[model samples]
Target: MNDFSKTDRLMERGSAFLGSRYAILCGAMSWVSERHLVSAISNAGGFGVIACGAMTPEQLETEIAATQELTDKPFGVNLITMHPQLFDLIEVCDKAGVSHVVLAGGIPPKGSVEAIKGGQNPAKVICFAPTLALAKKLLRSGADALVIEGMEAGGHIGPVSTSVLAQEMLPELSQDHIIFVAGGIGRGNAMAGYLEMGAAGVQLGTRFACAKESIAHENFKKAFFRANARDAVASVQVDARLPVIPVRALKNKGTEEFTQKQREVAGVLDRNEIAMEEAQLQIEHYWAGALRRAVIDGDVENGSLMAGQSVGMVKEEEPAADIIAKLMTQSEDALTRR
Candidate 1:
């Protein structure tokens, strides 16, 4: 039987978040957190979140159904708030009986939140907030909980790191409002550490990206396996005037290419050769297609391989179940050692 005294604070919080066995959560990752991966994580006793970026409402419905077919356990659908079909996606999720819906990429639009909260079959709405103010705003605007994401997280990140966000927000937010910590969280020990810091649970994205059940391309996973802690750094401008979102990633062909392109674009804008809007559009398009090629086609060298700094810690691919179990074991071990 599992030992309760050996349970770490994070494990206890995670158990409370899930309201059942296990304190692990499979983070919602773009292009990779599909039905199979979500179901795999959930069935293994962790909360799995399906990333619904750029998907049409109809597409989300099919994916949600596919996930349901794979597991009867609770799972969540992650919606990109900036997506044009955000409202429709919420409708689809409501119809699918999705237990939880996480809104990422900016604060959730009020209309979307109202719809989700007011619907006859309303689902729990979870959103990511960068600061305590944002977290308070989300909760006031109908969010059931918040996933406090730090700059160290993969994909689009906020200005603050998870450490600061947690320190700033957790102290103010009431315990009734669930707060899950995200960014640079990979192992069970890390999860326990956050729990001690007052997080209800930890959301992990990068480590799962390399899991055997993950849909991330083989080359993408290989890059993560090859990464070292030193290899993962946030992007910086080549010139003082030009800056981009501080995305943390492994230094590889894709990252280098993106940085070089940013430098060139900044040069053009500084010289008034290109409009700021035009330069921004070009950068956005480049990243859009680049991420698709890397995630969908497995072209790691040219595609945007988004990952968290914790990626350097990932050495190999294992089944989602094994990863979850190992994390729990590690958390237990950490508690005993303490």
Candidate 2:
């Protein structure tokens, strides 16, 4: 079935705009979404995004060059907003002629959108809209599209569910912002529902994390296959003064240790053993490099197995092309029945 069919009007428009055979965008994952997975996803029809989680501009340039060597299909690069050298990274993306750029991890910094659009051939900028106000602000800031992701997503997530976000943003801003629903999506029927409601498309991460072309360690892929929705737990806010944001991942030895570390820090803060700032920094340091430890080193028990609740829906490792084809078929069946 043609992805650009008129039956699903908004999805077709999204596919055309993204210059992909399908409208699905593979959500970028740190240490996981590298050259192999990104190229495979792009070549397989879905839009692939490279996660620049902690890459310096120089490293980002090298990775972008490597991905280019693998596939000629259009793909996007995801830049974390908090990266200190953000402007420099944008320069690297522009220099590489990257067609699209996604600004993720909290609201984009001021002038971020302009910096992205200022390139010789402006790249389309997509941002995550955590609230309706942020969605409007991103649009006002010149974002070409918005991804409304919810808490069910893996890694850092907002409080709302994907269904609620679609209800709130898609109906109002889908026409203007090209809204793509993310978080907790595992099946085509669910995606079909969102498109019917008004979403231009959808973004998926956990579904693609275990793709055959993904460079994740076998332990990471095995963990995802063995997990269920309930097993994917979100980090808790242990203390108000500590200022720890929740991170969703599979419950593991590392997770338990994180809890104990937070408790130890909280006790030290109470006794004035460390300043609040230092305590917060201590909490932040707990998970640093943990994702890479699991993804690259195969240390699933002690490293972060960041995966969405949709892990329950993943049963095996498959090629990226097969995954995209199955989703399209499922979506078409649902739409035709409707």
Candidate 3:
């Protein structure tokens, strides 16, 4: 491996935490982040997280085993906090001896962290904190690290932009805790700025979703190659009371369809056909299914083309190793120029 002294220096804390050569993490994208891409990222010296999106414990176990077969390097598992079988999935990770667990989609429902950390082999718990206060609270709540993703990211996102979240959260928590800044990060210079601001590392989703190793469909990758920043738009909340989190994706018939789906779910919610938790899960399930359609089934026009604003930077298919090397080289060059 080439010496990236400056970049490595800045990434020291995060690298140590993730047990990877670089602090870069591949943001877990449902179908795209399966064994192939995840192992490729880890083999490339960056951390790869398995997206255990809506997967049952048995499935997560099989994925973990498959990923381990591909790479001995460390990686993490991203589990949805709201998954009905959250604890069972945690057990699968525990049995697999996974190193890190990222809890996303909401606050770690009480004891979820404990359950993750309590196994014979404890895993570091990484949580998503959208705000400064929540960052502190998660840190205090036994979270080993935090990823502050902004609205600029693909899929479900918070209201703030990456720049704003970095300025707000990095200085406050980065000194004493491990914090990874994500969202709208497409290049190395942007990464350099965050490291200078005390970010432990960075996470990127859209940038890697179409890597040569990713299993995303050809149509899905083509849509990303053809898209611009403006093409990636966030879905509008059809009803405020439904507790729907806005999703960012490429505009298509599916985008409009989601609004209608939300309305339909809201009607069910209104009629008390399902409880609030069930309603929320219904919406999440919709996204998972839609994403699979685009990523796995090549239904880009009707499936959810979840992408970050960085989609504009993805020019073509490249090996994961080349991608990591390029980003690290660029980051090092930027640091040196400074």
**Which candidate has the highest lDDT of all?**
3
lDDT of each: 0.78, 0.88, 0.94
Clashes found in each candidate (C-alpha, N, C closer than 3 A): 0, 0, 0
Residue 234, candidate 3: alpha-carbon lDDT? 97
Residue 204 in model 2: shift from native, Å?
Answer: 0.2
Count of backbone collisions within predicted model 2: 0
TM-score, candidate 2, is: 0.93
Residue 88 displacement (Å), model 2: 1.0
Tell me the lDDT of candidate 2.
0.88
Candidate 3 lDDT over 179-200, as tens digits, reads 9999999998899889999999
- The stretch of ten residues in a row with the least summed lDDT in candidate 1 is 4-13
Single out the weakest 10-residue window by summed lDDT for candidate 2. 1-10
Tell me each candidate's TM-score. Answer: 0.87, 0.93, 0.99
Write candidate 1's Cα lDDT for 153-266 as tens digits.
887777788887887887777456678888888777877677776777778888888888888888888888988766677766576565455666666688888888988898
